[model samples]
Every structure is written in C-alpha cells, then in structure tokens.
Target: MTDLAKTDRPRTPVLDRVTLPSDLKGLSDRELRQLADELRAETISAVSVTGGHLGAGLGVVELTVALHAVFETPRDKIIWDVGHQCYPHKILTGRRDRIRTLRMGGGLAGFTKRAESPYDPFGAGHSSTSISAALGFAVARDLGGDPGDAIAVIGDGAMSAGMAFEAMNNAGHLGKRLFVILNDNEMSIAPPTGALSTYLTRLYTGGPFQELKAAAKGAVSLLPSPMQEGARRAKEMLKGMAVGGTLFEELGFSYIGPVDGHDLDQLLPLLRTVRARADGPVLIHAVTKKGKGYAPAENADDRGHARGRFDVLTGQQAKAKSNAPSYTSVFARALIDEAGRDDRILGITAAMPDGTGLKQFAERFPRRTFDVGIAEQHAVTFAAGLAAGGMKPFCALYSTFLQRGYDQIVHDVAVQGLPVRFAIDRAGLVGQDGPTHAGAYDIAFLSNLPGFVVMAAADEAELVHMVATAAAHDAGPIAFRFPRGEGTGVEMPERGEILPIGRGRMIAEGHSVAILSFGTRLSEAMAARESLSARGISPTIADARFARPLDRDLILKLAAGHDALITLEEGAVGGFGSHVAQLLADEGVFDRGLAFRSMVLPDRFIDHDAPYAMYDDSALNAAHIEAKVLEVLKIGQLDRRA
Candidate 1:
C-alpha cells in the first residue's frame, strides 16, 4: 500500500468543489483530472462503508468523469450497462449525500435506477442490455420523444452476451445516431470467456497498441496536422483488429479506440471529437484495468468485483464467521461428489461459475464444466443438447438470471423432454442486490411447465439429497432451488440419498393446524411451531420438497388431519401454495369447511436490506407465520410486534 492507500478516507478537494455533472463544465482539464482521482478515492471509501461493486467503479473513474463532462446527461441520456459501475456516477449525479446508504432499505439502489436520479435515464442490474436501451432512446429522440443523444457505457463482459450483438445489429441496420463506449477491462465478474475476448486481447497485444498515445492525439481533428498521418496508420490498425473493417464499422458505426480509459487527456479529446463531429453510431473501445488505483483490489483475483463491508486500510472484509457452510457450497460439494461417481455429469454456468459455486466443479472436472459467457439462453439450450446426447447436465444459474433463458427452458428442454438438471441458486430474496436480482419467480414459472419436476431445499442436507435425486432421475427436466446464505447448522451426511419423487417428509406431527413449508422457510415454520406449542397449539410441520408434483399425498393427508392448514415458501404467490390450493380445490377438500391460508412474498418488489429485514417486510418470517396461524385458527390476536 502506498501513502494514498494508507489513509482510509483520502482528501477529496476537487470532488468537494462540485456535486453534479454540470459542475465539470467550468473546471479546466487539469482540475477535471484531479476530480477523477478524488472521485476514485471517494468511490473506494463509499464502497468500503456500503460494501458493493468496487473494481468496476474504479475502472471507470476517468470515463465517468469524461462522460458527464462531455455529454449533456438527463437531456442527453447516458445508460450504464449492468449498473455495477455506477457508484461514481451516482455521486456526481447529486446522490453523494446518500452514498453510504446504497443498497440498504430506503437508500440509493446499488444499480442505476431511473427513479433514483434524473441523470439515470435507464436502470440496470443484469448485464448486456445497454446497447438495445440506448438504441431505443436514440429512436425515441428521432420520433419526437425526450430529445437527446443516447450513449451507453458497457463492459467487455456485458458485450459478450448475445443481446449486445442483437442490439448492435439492429442499431447498424437502423443507422441511428448512438454512442457505445466499451470499457474493456479484460474481466467481468469472472474473467470474461469467449472468442470475442480473445479477439479483444489480440488488439491489446498487437504491435500498434504501444503507439496509442500518439495515435489517439492524431486520430481526432482537434490535434495538429502532424498527427493526421498517425491517424491514418491507426485507422489501418483498427481495420486489422476487426478483420474486414473494425467490428463496429462493419456494424455501421464509426469505431474509435483501443485508447487508455484511465488517461483523461486521451478520453476527453476523443469524446469531445465524437460528440462534436459524429453523425451515425459510434463504438469507442477504451482499454481499462479493473481495480485501477487501489493496490489491494488490483492485486486480488477478481479486482474487488464484489465485497462485504471492509477495512479500507488492509482491504480485509468484515464478514461474520458462520459454522455452517452456505447453501451454494453444499450444492457445489454435492455435485462434485456425484460427478465423481458418474463420468457423464457435466456442469454449465452463464458467466457465474463462482457466484453459483460451480468453480470447484470446473476445477475438479475441467473438461466437463462449460462457462457460456453471460448467455443464459445458450447455456440452457446447450445443456439440453448435452442431456439429449445421454449425458447428465446440471445447468446452474441464479433464479433471476434464469429468467433470460425461459424461452430456451420451455421449448428446448421441457418440450423436448430432455433430462437437464437445473440447479437454481439464489432462489429467494437476495440481499443488497435488490429487486432486479431477486430470485422470486422460478417456482411459479417452472412449476407451470408440464413434465418439469421442481423442488426446493428445506436445508443444506436436503440440497445434497436433491442433487443426488436430480443426478439419478433420467426422465424429463428436474430443478431444485436453494436460497442465498449459510444453511442451518445441521450435521453433514456421508452421502446424499436419491429421495423419492413427489414425496414430502414430515418433520413434526401435532393437532389442530398443520404448517407445510416448501423451501428454506421450513426453519421459520418450525420456529412458529414452537411459539404455537406454548399456547397449547402443536401444529404439524412438513417440508414439501417437490413443488411441481404437488407432494399430493403429504398435502392431502395434512389437510385431512388438521382443522386449518398453512403453506410457507420463499417465492411469490402462485407458487407451491397455489399449486397446493389447486389440488385441494380439485379434490373438494375446501368444500369440507377446512380453513386455509398461504404465506408468501407480497405482490410488490422488496428493496435491498438485511435478508431478515426484507423477509420481515415480505411478511414471510416466523412471526408472520405465527400471525397467519392465529388468524386462520381465530386464536391468539395478531400481534407481530409482540
């Protein structure tokens, strides 16, 4: 760590002078560079407090300053792709006072949200949608909507997704006036993987890359006449880099760069020239380093892609020690164990190997793991193909990200009756990342598909059993969802059992009202059971492991044996509870005068906060479960606070 690194909160003189993008207009070039440095420091400090995406914001400090200074913003829309890199943007756009409150309840969103600020014309959480959104803004301006230039700052990782290409193709075809600044940092959440990444690397390592300073000065009309000759040579290099004309040029846009993203002198002049003279679409390839200034981040593997609240002096995170392993790790180990027994077991992830805990599986069976870069659509279909070929494929993805592949899931896997084991991680309300990243709809969506077996893990042990069950089942599609954090401190089993399909195990049996839990909420249901027992109301408790098959026998038996029944799950309405209700209605169980209720996530989006707080807001916690029981049985008064 340097002198700058030694101080947790570095002085921000230039940053303190201004609060908005317009403030950059009057500052000289030297002052603006100073501002960028301070902005970088401020970003690090804020994330050190709030704990979120750090590397991305650091990578784009200069670019963020340059874009705000060059573009008119609000009027001239600047859409940030994936929005993880928008922390600095948030500060400059008049949200500095609330910086520490980012990703917390009632605070600023971690991503760029339209409602958060005027400068944030488009919101984002997932990657690779910026170009399409920018094109929309451009088209909207042309058609007499909010008139302004549409600019999108996207990362190389986001560009690797298929949607970026789709948007680029359409933008090229339409020949709209748009700006796409590609922040090529050689890394996304994981080191970006694909042919395109290799191509971009070739551009960086190519002979002309060293002459970027001279070439950049010459390439723009603002420079002296001597640089014009260098501009011609640089254009030739660009063509070579893109093969038959630069890739963006072939897509009908003016392609500029392989410029230094961190250098204000290079970025400012180029952006000024583009903003002044460009007529059609333009793609600026700015090469940057992830975790640009901070030594601890630059030296780390992921460049501080994400973190918990950390000590700025040492860059050590402040995470509480948990005795139990996380649900993600349990799934990973169980899959690795199963793969050891079966050679045909393959793993696939859409640019989230580490996030889904598939990195270990990839390391153990290198040939068997496939990372389809940010392309969930391709990942699902590829897994279907592997399954069709008689190989067991586990397509692991976050529940929210899996939404991108729904078409593939419905047509390619479900319709084809392929045996693709879908390991759905983050299957409930995700903390900090907020509503955009919430895994709330998978149960409802997957359960509706015929021949699709949907299951949820009630605990880490159950997750292991589901993994084995998914591996053994060679029928149609099978999915098992598990939530985001560490599991209950349950003892580990020697190996997982291939649990019986469509069957639920009873945890406890008692009188009056039975409580059925579908997923990790089983723990909450049990807690509620204890409270109920104190009032001489011992409610039966069971885990409905399989949601799609309805756990028919268990549900029907529970309803018959109890006066009032309640269903608990971490998903939204129309999920396990709805399925259970439909089964009861079909059987005329409701006609037997049995009171029933279903506790689930409310019908609106829950903002970022502590996981327990978000669950409390959603009214799916143990206290809420107890209240539902009291309400249904008409016993203890509804006093959640008590």
Candidate 2:
C-alpha cells in the first residue's frame, strides 16, 4: 500500500475488522471517522467499477459512520428509507473487500438486504419505507422487553410519499421509542416542492432563530429566581408560537435540530446528545448536500442522482459508440410525434420525468405535463382523474415504480375502466441498478388486473405502433412496456398506426417448434431462430403483443401446429409466459403430447451488470434460449429412436 493508503488502513480497520454490528462497539470516535472517510473512498471506487448509485451514497457517508459508532446496530435497529444511501453502510459493516463487485451477479446488492447483513434490520429498495420498518422494530423490541433503539433515516424526497406521512402519524400517536432522521438535502432527484420543503427551510436557515435564542438567554440570566420562573413560562409560550415544529409537535414527537449534517463537529455531539436524552419519538432534521465533496455531481442537473462511470477530475461521462437509439429516446420521440397531432394529449410522471422520457413532452406542452414527486399512487389516480375530465393522460413510469401503485391500477383505473394510458419504461433487467431497480414484476401485477390491455414493444418501431394503439383506444386502461436501454436497429415507422387488439403477427413460418416472445426479448428470440435454423431445426417466431386479453386465436393456433411451444418474456413468474400457460391449461391444449417451457426471470433477485450478461445469468439470452431448444428436441429424438 502507498503512504496515503497506509495511514488510511485500519490497524484492524473498523470497516474491514468488523463483519457484524457487535464488533463496532470497541472502536473509538476518531477511528470511526477515519473509517467513514475510507468507506467513502471505497464506495466511489466501487461504483466506478460496478456502475451503480453515486450521489446518495456520498451524502450519507458521515451519518452512517456516526450512527454505527454511537449505537449498537443489528440489536438496535436502523432502517434506511429508499436504501440507495446504504453503500457506505455496506462498506463499514464487513463487506468492504467485496465492494468492487457491488451489483454484479452473485455479488453484494446495491441496496440493503436482510439476508446479506445482520446490520441491515430491514431490506429496502423503494423509497419512504424506513419509518414504518423502524416503527415495527420499535414495537417488537417493546413486546420482547429488549432494550434497543429504532432509528429511521429518510430523505426529503421520500418524505413526499403518503406512506411516510402515515407512518409518522402512527408513530407519533403511539409515542413509541423511535428516532426519525429526516436527512434534508433540500432535494430528492430534483429540488423538492410543496409546503414541507418550505417549513424545513425555515427550521434550518437560523435567521431569526439564533437572534431570538441569544436575547432570551441574556434576559433569563439577568432575572431573579422568582422573575426567572415567570420569564421561563413566557419564553415557552413565545417559542411555541414562533417555531415551525408545531406540525411534528402536534403529531406527538419531540422534534429537534435542523442541524448541519455535513459538519462532524455538529453531527457527532448532537447525535450523542439525542442518544442520551428524550424517551418518546424524536425527529432530527439534518441538512446535508447530495454530492458534498464531488464537484461534477454537485453541479449536475439532477445532482448526479444516478450516474454512470465518469472522469474523476472533469466529471464527464465515459463515451461509447451509439449503434441505435435508446428505448427511452425512442419513446420520447414517439410521444412527441403523437402529441404534436393530438391537442388533448397530456403527460404525467411520478418524479421520473427524465427517466420515463417525459422531459420532451414537458418542454413541448409545459402546462399538460405533471411531475408528481415520488408519488406513484397519486400519479396514477391523478391521471385517471384527468382522463375522466376529458383529457388524454399518458402516465409514464418505470415498471418497478409502477408496482408501488398496483392497488391504484386495480381500484381507480382498471376497475372503473378509465382511459389512463401507461407508458411503462424499464420493463426488463436494468444493468447496474440490480434487482431492486429491476422491472420484473409489473407484467405479473398488471396482467392480472381486469379490463387492462397490456402490450410489450419488440423494438422502437413497434413502440410507436403501441403508443398509437394506446391513444386510439380511449374506452379503457391501456399500457405498453419497453426495456431500459436502446432498441434494435429496426427501421423507424413513418407514421403511428394502431394494431388490432388481441391479435399478433408471425415473424417467420416454420415446423415442429414455435418460439413465442413478448417485449424486448423478441430480438434475442430472432437470434435463437437463426441459430436453430442453421442446425436444420427451423422454428416459428411470433411476438405476442397483448399479455392480458391474450390473442386467443393466435396462441391456440401456434400451440396446435407446433410440436413444442417455448414462451419467452422479460418478466418474473406469473407474467406473459405464465398467462400463456394458463390459457393452454384452460383449453386443455396440453392434453395432447407437447413440450412446453416458460422462460422468465429466475425466482431469485438478479444482480446488476450489462443487460446482456444479466439476461444470460437468468437464461433469457439467445445462447441460453438456443441451448434450451436443443435440450427439448434431443429428448424427442431419443423417444423417436426408441
């Protein structure tokens, strides 16, 4: 190790020395801070290699270091809301050596996992879950008569969600022993909006607060004991009227500091004070910067909310040759094309205007586009309400985030049969983000809802057609899902046209085997088709557009004609393939001898890597698909030889 590396290395470093929380107790405060700095450097290097979450981890470095240093973790629960900020926590808790492989297949997860570390009391990927998880831990501790603490670290962005508010209300009403750290960075991915952000701003700025406190202390020190008692009562009354914590106070928690989260001098002493004093619920508002030490991320558009590998000095992204347009860009262009013609069209996103390709729409029709921050449930219902009010609303969201609004999909839109169009992006394995960010469950959840028309795009051209199909069909709820990255270099459609619902087209005609694919996996299925053809095993290929309201006639025809049916989808169990299996089972089509295999995401959560590598691990790649096809055919050949 170099001289700088030598000084940083623990003589039995807290980061490398301890795998479990119990091992954290012996370390001194000075050593803990050194460990924090080391953890930060390790995280930055690891994410550069693994290409995962960046800014969130950087912001939480000191907080993670301080929390572990003060508290007995695992025994005393600390629940991380959104879990994106857990990388530093992972580094200090015995996973430092494995950090470089973060988010890769069979490596450490990008988010907190209960199974991965005992220090992670509750697993989380979604935002705004910490308060509830911490509350649960609090109640469990009380019932078991365990002397332990429950701390929840939530960001300003997550505080916008309804669930966070609900948890706060319940925790306050119960008056349990819980500590809620509102990590106020004054932004989520973007600058936070609403009344709460304004209130937090007042609490932290210390403009009038510092002046009033000094004057009051001077007055109290000068008074006699009898006069001081009277002054104390008056001071309490004036402070109550002036301070903004009435909201948290009303909710029943003892609220404390809008402290400087970045300053270790302020943070360590304040944390120790809070640890010693107060019994009931407490809310500590700690203000910090998203990209504190890194200049590039600090000045970026979204505060480098999610970043790829970049130059450490200049902070420019590593360049790659563009072969084809990304799926997000394609979706954006297609939406722009549709919106240009239709005046009634409007776009809405749940805090992901950029991620879901709604930025161009926001630019074109500023009044028509809505960026409802981190509130997926509200975004869906809000879109449904817009549709009911005689406007075409396209609620663009990621496939994973849409799962947060599953109830809204069933209760508000599908049940009512509202005309809410869903432009679901990231429909498959998202490289580097790992399983937590994977768009694996939307197909399963949405397909099961009634009166829902679900379509998966095979390419950018098909995405255009699907978008047009959604716009034209104003009678009920409709959705089209596409994968994260770029599309296949298919020719772009000149004009948007609607495809017939409950119908699919054959890509190629063949005998013996029919390969049915849904969504982005169509490209891989085509490759498998070519490979199988070269071996004299010609196979049929079809893109099943609609997962729900399945193409009954097309699916049945393919199953009857082909000796074997191989169904493929870039989703989890009980998705497109499962739906096909259900239809085949219902019709008794499987009574006749036929080999069937449903190719879907594995039962385990997939890790982050390149999209192709992730697919390969889950057996969804072209090579694996070809190998599976050969294995099935070989079994049939053995019977024929017999």
Candidate 3:
C-alpha cells in the first residue's frame, strides 16, 4: 500500500485493506458486502473535509468495487462518463492521501484525468461521452490483437443526450464486445428528462410483468410441443407489453437487468456473468440511489448535486463568510426585475437553472422559463421561436455550453436576425469546473456570427448595464457574458441604462502602451495599471464592450497613439483577441511590427482549481499582465521590490 493510503488515525478496513483491484480476488462474497460498508464510510469522511461531487461518489461505491474486482483496471479500460463519480475510483488507484487536495491548485483533479493517473483511461468533464470513447478503445484493442474488455459506465441522466443515442446506434451496428453499464441513479443535476427518462420510469414500474412471464413459461413447459408453441407465442406477446424491449433491442444491443446496484451479491455475480459472455454490445442496467449512505446528502432537495465543505453529522454547508452578493444571485435578481416589468420577457437554460441563476425565474414564471435538459441546440432554437412569436426571450446558457449551439446561433438566431437575448454565465475560466465548463469559446463563436452583438461585463455595475443593453436592443441576437462566483462588490446603479454600441470607455490613460481587455479580466488589467504606475510606467487601460463590432475606432485610435497594444481576454484561440489581430492586419496597424501578445487559455485543458489560482497558472493574472506590458515596452521585467 502507498503511504498516502495509510494514516495513523483509526481508519475503516474495507477500503484500506485493498490497494489494487487484484486484492479483491481473495475476498469472499460475504466480505465484499462488509467492504462496501467501510468504503462508503471512508468516502463520506473524505468528502466532509474536501467538498466535491459527494452524492455521485457515494452512489457508485458498491458498483465501483465490483467492477474493479472483476476487471483488470489500468490494463482493461474502464471509462467513467462525466467523471463526477470517479472519486472512489481515484481513492482505489493510489491517490488516497491527495484526496483532501481535490479541486485545489497543484493538487488532485476533481475529474478523471489522463495526465493525473494511468488508471484513468480517458479524461472527461462533459456528460454522455463515455460510450463513444470506450468504443474507440475497443476498436484500437481489436486492431492491436489485444483481448482486453472496454467498459463504459454511463448514468441514466446522461442517456437523455442525443450523443449517447448516436454512440449506441453506431456501437450496435459495428457489433463489437464492448460493455456499457447504465448507472441509473434516476437523476441528472436535476431529475432526468425527455423520452429516455419516461422509458426508465416504465422499466422501474413494470418489473412484475417479467415475473409473471417467467411463471407462465414454467407452467407451459409441461404441455406437448403444439401446446408449448402456442404458449410461447402468448409469452412473446406479454413481453411486447413491457418497455425497454423495443427501444434498446431495435438499437441492436442485448439489454440486461434493471438490477439493484447497491447489492454487491447481485452486482458481482451479474458482472461475472456479463464478463464471461461473448456477446456484442450488452447493456447492464443498474439502479442505485444518489447520496445512498450519507444522511445529510440523501435528504437534500437536490440530493447534494454540488456541495461545499459540510458538517458530517449536521448537514450544514461550510462556506466562507462573504460581504458581497454572488454574481449569479445578482444576475438572477436582475432577470427577475426585467421579467416583472415586461410581459413579453421569457427565460431559457440548458439543464442548469440553479447554476445559471434562472431558478427564481423558473419558479415564478414557469411557463416563460424553459430548462431544455442539456440540449444547447434545442435551447437556442426554442428561444428563437419565442422571439418570432413577439416575445423577448433570454437564453441563459453557460459560455462553454453555448459551444454546442454554435450552428444554432448562426442558422436559427443570427441568419434570420431574431432578437434573442443571451445571458452567458461563466464567461471566463470558471473555478474548479475547469476548461470543459469554461466560457472560453463564446466570444469567438458569437462574434463571428453575422448579426450577433457580443458584450462582456467589466464589473457588477457594468453587468447591470449590459443586461439592460441586451433587453433594450431588438436589432438581433445579443449576448452579455459574465464570470462565475461573486462580483467586484461595486455599488450597482439605480437604473440599468443602455451603453452606446460599438464603443469602449477608458479606465486610465497612458502613453507607453494601451491594454485593450475584454470580459472579467478587466479587474486584472486594473491591478496591472497600478503595478505599472508604481514602477514609473504609465499604461492606458480600456474595457472594450463589443467584441463582434471590435470597437474598431477605439482600438485603432489606441494603436496609433500608444507605443504598443496589449490584448487580453479569458478565452481560447478563436475569441476576441484573434479578431483584434485580424482587424490590425487589415488596417496595417502592425505594418511596423507592433510588439503585442494575445494572452489566452493555453492549448491544453486546465484542471479543477480556485478561479484565482487558475488565472495565475494560465498567465491571466495582474502580475503577468503587468510583466507582459513591461516586456512589450522593452522595459524588462517589473521589479517586485520597486
């Protein structure tokens, strides 16, 4: 056992007893039950100190142990979809001591990361991608003449996604020995939705029919061949009445049980049976409860979807004391304020009401607010329909999620010039959720859309104005992106008024260089300005509001006047910074070779950590910005003591 897995404190034996999956080979069936109990206790204890995906980890304990025992992990590939439930998998795979540092800077990642451990076959943060990735591994193994099994453990909620269905259809047609375990916890962050949820509900309720058919078959076996044939025909008719038969069987997968996932006795035996079989594309449906063992998590309204540090016994969340209202809360209130005054105002989200701050709007104006169950494509078009019907619709989707609806933004909203307001949350490198959930591509994608009005909030005050600006503008599709967590604690304006379009306001004036920043990084630019001022270097700073319009006049004027232009934004390659470069090239602003750098998220995906630490690591912090400006002016690095 690794030293990290061992502690001086009296620890539970079930988890501590086993270091590798091979250790489970000696344990009897009875001992497996006891092991599951100890594992659950350990998981609860670990999450109490370091809050993360608690409910998911607890729910999958028995199944995880069973799979590890049955399959040779780090050899046989086991792909966990979304990776929120991989905490147990991580603990077992030699990262036990580092569990406390989950979601922190320079610590263990919160999700299944390929770079972090060899045990993680594929890295995932987004949902409904396991089956596709697992199938790829299965194909690779076959080509290499390897006989390892590829298993994809996907949740019932993730099954609702079109991508999951697409993978299933493709997997069925190809017909390989790939195994898909449908972990039916009966929930997504919220309750499951669409036709898939309905099918699962039918499967849950219609179990008695299977028993009746089995008993009828036993009774018919005593009869002669002619009678038996007729009875068999009747039995076939009976099975047609049950759900999950036609839908999955039609898709070409041999579907197995809606078995109890918590029962190690049932789970282990069923797994062994499936593993031994030489079938093509089999799905084992296992039902488990989210937050099964922990009392507090089990009782929470959302089933502890995402939680902060909490008292183990009391169930109260441990949060840092804050003087300012969260940005999400403020946005929610502002949306409500707008909705109250305008009868035509409507709201939409892609499976994140609570996260996107549309919960209140959903509660008060149920008809107007639509939660489109992780389908970003549908959400955009649905908002377009509302706009077409003379309603003012605000599509509140996270910036990263909007990437899914890029085609929709261009074809449905922008092409027709529908007046749809987009409240884009998590517009920057969001803390902890990491690159997969970061609002990195919205500015780039939305700006390129022909009739889109792309704006970024400088602070809480500017967010209010932008919200007003979006609401007031009926020209086309307008988006205002904001960062996650709290605002700058700035005093809000009495009334939100529209800012002039295609214009930027200067924060500070300087001659050496002008920093043209977008989105939440404006705060870092302010800090850089102060840093520059103290070092006898005065640099001008401007918050460019419209990324699509490019604030061309403002940027052109700044470029011509200043010695160098510095563009900073919290996004990936194709965002606001790229547009600035294109405009500069076209205008011949860089004819004499302007010393500039586009500060963006690196080419690789960042892991989960605090927002501040993530920014610093990605070189999006104030000190980095200050140093970059100094470097551009040939002033060398900023002296920290000076």
Residue 245 of model 2, lDDT score = 56
Off by over 4 Å in 1: 1-8, 209-220, 223-230, 235-245, 639-642
Clashing pairs in 2: none
- Over 135-198, each residue of candidate 2 has an lDDT whose tens digit, in order, gives 8888988898555899999999899899999999999988888999889998887677667788
Would you list the C-alpha lDDT of every candidate in the order shown? Answer: 0.89, 0.80, 0.81
**Per-prediction TM-score to the true structure, in the order listed:** 0.96, 0.89, 0.91
lDDT of 1 at 481: 98
Clashes of each: 0, 0, 0
User: Over the full model, what C-alpha lDDT does candidate 3 score relative to the true structure?
Assistant: 0.81
The residue-by-residue lDDT of candidate 1 on 160-257, one tens digit each, is 99999999999999988899999999999999899989888887676333222334445445633333454667756654454422666678776765
Cα miss at 391, model 2 (Å)?
Answer: 1.1
lDDT of 2: 0.80
For residues 1-642, write the lDDT of model 3, one tens digit per residue. Answer: 112234523256666777777777788878777777777777776777778888988899999889988888878888999998988888778888787788877788778989889889899888889999988888888899445889999998888777888999999999988889889888878776677788887775765211112225375444323334544554675565645445676787766556778988767866776677545888877889998877788888677778888766676889887777777877888888878888788888877888888988888888888877867888999899999999999999888888888888889999999999999998878777776787777877788888788999888888888888888888888999888888888898876878898888898888878999887789889988887786788889999988977788998888888879998888888888899999999999889667667888877777668888888889989999998998898889878873
- TM-score, cand. 1: 0.96
Name the 10 consecutive residues with the lowest summed lDDT in model 3. Answer: 208-217
Give candidate 3 regions above 4 Å deviation: 1-10, 207-237, 240-244, 592-595
